[model samples]
Target: MCAVAAVLLASGASAQSGWGGGAFFNADVFRADREAWHEERLVVQRRFSAGAASLEGGTVSRNGFTDPFVATDLYARAGTRGYGNLRAQWAPEASGVPRLDLLAEAYAVVGTGWEASLGARHIVTASSAATLGTGSVAKYVGNWTVRARGVATLDETIAVSTSLSARYLFDGVGGLTAPFAEVTVGRGREPVVAAGGLEIRPSWVVNGRVQREVRSGFGVSASLGYIWDDSLTRWTGGLGVTGRF
Candidate 1:
């Protein structure tokens, strides 16, 4: 396989993956209860063979809800032993009431295409918390990918919720494209919402996504991303325009 083909194969055809240290921007818009809410997240990250460090900033605002707030997240991760990995994340308090949150998680890669993860969450301002931990599992079954995650919050106002999602990958559909669908059911305000989307990688180093969100209301989102690598040589720029990393 060529170098570019190797990268794409290692990526498992995921469009949102970055090769190494790079910058990525993502934005999300939500509509619920006849109100509009939006969030924009910017991330700068560095990834190595054994671990990674990432810093992310997010701004969220909604009508009739709390005022617009910005939050910072610091993350660090490392590989443990024999298919085990550890990760930690810190989100500083930025809400009006100011409650910091910390989460620690571990993941184990089982078999060839199965992964199990467990997480613990803590709210710095609350003496009371949730139960022991939350668990999730993800598996890739041939061209079909499956993921299910559940979270238990310590806050009394929020209920325990779990989300299930799946995607069917079309490796030979004229281009790199996949159709995905998700459904979430819980006791929350928007008890149930159904979403469907498509992730398309029309180019070797560029990709885009478009999705529709449905619940009590409806909305849509779109994003475009790009990535390139020149790590194979620093002086390739002087050689020619068609340089390879």
Candidate 2:
């Protein structure tokens, strides 16, 4: 996790020249008998526009679930964890339309696994745009996961997005491939903004989330989720605080 974070920090410094960080917590309420988990993440990013080319990277942590076997049972256990990612962006001047943005990124769970993705961004309206990307990750021996996502912003005040991801495992331990999707709505202003999303994890889980922002460099968020496993169904929720300077 530390290595990933360092890589991200390095990417940010090498590309943009800015620094920022945030934290979040999640709780499951359905299965009150189980312990709730929390996660914290921080990032420092910089964007350098050198003739329409840019690069960025930063560190991230998810807390808990370090052991792949234990992480697989995340539906039952809770804890803290971390990961890292490196990304690059590029934009070239166009004749009459808005410039197009392209991005490529690589990520890893410290020592466990890694993934790579490529994406594109196109402005659809004055305050709205859309993004598309594809990526794959090595999860376990003979197991791999692929993800495709699309996100669109309708207005400066409201945004919506969704993604479809699939995973295949060689061993019988993992379930068959499935699709997942999510939608987010956000309202942004000078110092504060409110955002929320509903996520469906196919046969695994469903979640609802909301967050509030403060202009004083601090913010908080909360979420409630339900997990359906082979053994039982559970609910979880959590709250988190973040700051920036």
Candidate 3:
């Protein structure tokens, strides 16, 4: 889910400045058939007093096809305690990727150190189109954060999935370091393996990552994940670098 990645990027260490830029690479390997997929992206962002905007461009290789795509996102504050994000993406003439995707969400601070959000997503591919709904709630306790999220597809057959995650931010002399873990279960589609010509299947995933501010305005992160679905098992890994000025 690109939405999940957007949320994380908005809250992670890279979001601490007026301007930021980053690059990321990720790979997934399916054990059942020895197939591999890869993705890379570059991001540029600017934060204003009441809002932020970002642009991303990337290439994805999957199922023996490669395509380039571009996406843009806007984040604005609704009030002192409410905010929202809107994103759109396009990949022209892509067969194994979404031809167009859009997401919109509104979030609010529900209570002290608590937040919640509701959102919707639409994806169109060369052969089919699907719409999905999403929601999430998060809590911040001292230097730790926990969140729960759910996604449901509203196609002919309904498929739902839930994910839970926790992160601890370590503050030190140079910068901040965060360690994160997440688990998801259900039949919902995961973001890792983009929904191209793939069908919805029951799946579970475990993911772990560490993000660190290497210097005052620079950061790096690494992630590893394992997924098991009805037909295949997959291993995924990712690396990212970001900078702010």
lDDT scores in order: 0.34, 0.30, 0.71
Q: Locate the minimum summed-lDDT window of 10 residues in model 2.
A: 68-77
User: Could you tell me which 10 consecutive residues in candidate 3 have the lowest summed lDDT?
Assistant: 172-181
What is the number of backbone collisions in each predicted candidate, taken in the order shown? Answer: 0, 24, 1
After superposition, the stretches of candidate 1 with alpha carbons farther than 4 Å from their true spots are 1-35, 63-93, 96-98, 124-132, 142-144, 154-159, 167-245
TM-score against native, each model: 0.47, 0.33, 0.86
User: How do the residues 1-245 of candidate 2 rate in per-residue lDDT, one tens digit apiece?
Assistant: 11111221111112112333344343433353544333333333222222111122222121222111000000111112222233322222222121223333433333344333333333321222444433333332233333334343333433434444443322222110111112222211111101111111223445544434455545555666665552235665655554444
- How much is the lDDT of residue 16 in candidate 1? 22
TM-score-better candidate, 1 vs 2: 1
Candidate 3's clash total is 1
Q: Pick the candidate with the highest TM-score.
A: 3
Q: Residue 40 deviation, candidate 1, in Å? A: 2.1
State residue 109's C-alpha deviation in candidate 1, in Å: 2.2
Error of 2 at 243 (Å): 3.0
The TM-score of predicted model 3 comes to 0.86
Estimate candidate 3's alpha-carbon lDDT, on a 0 to 1 scale. 0.71
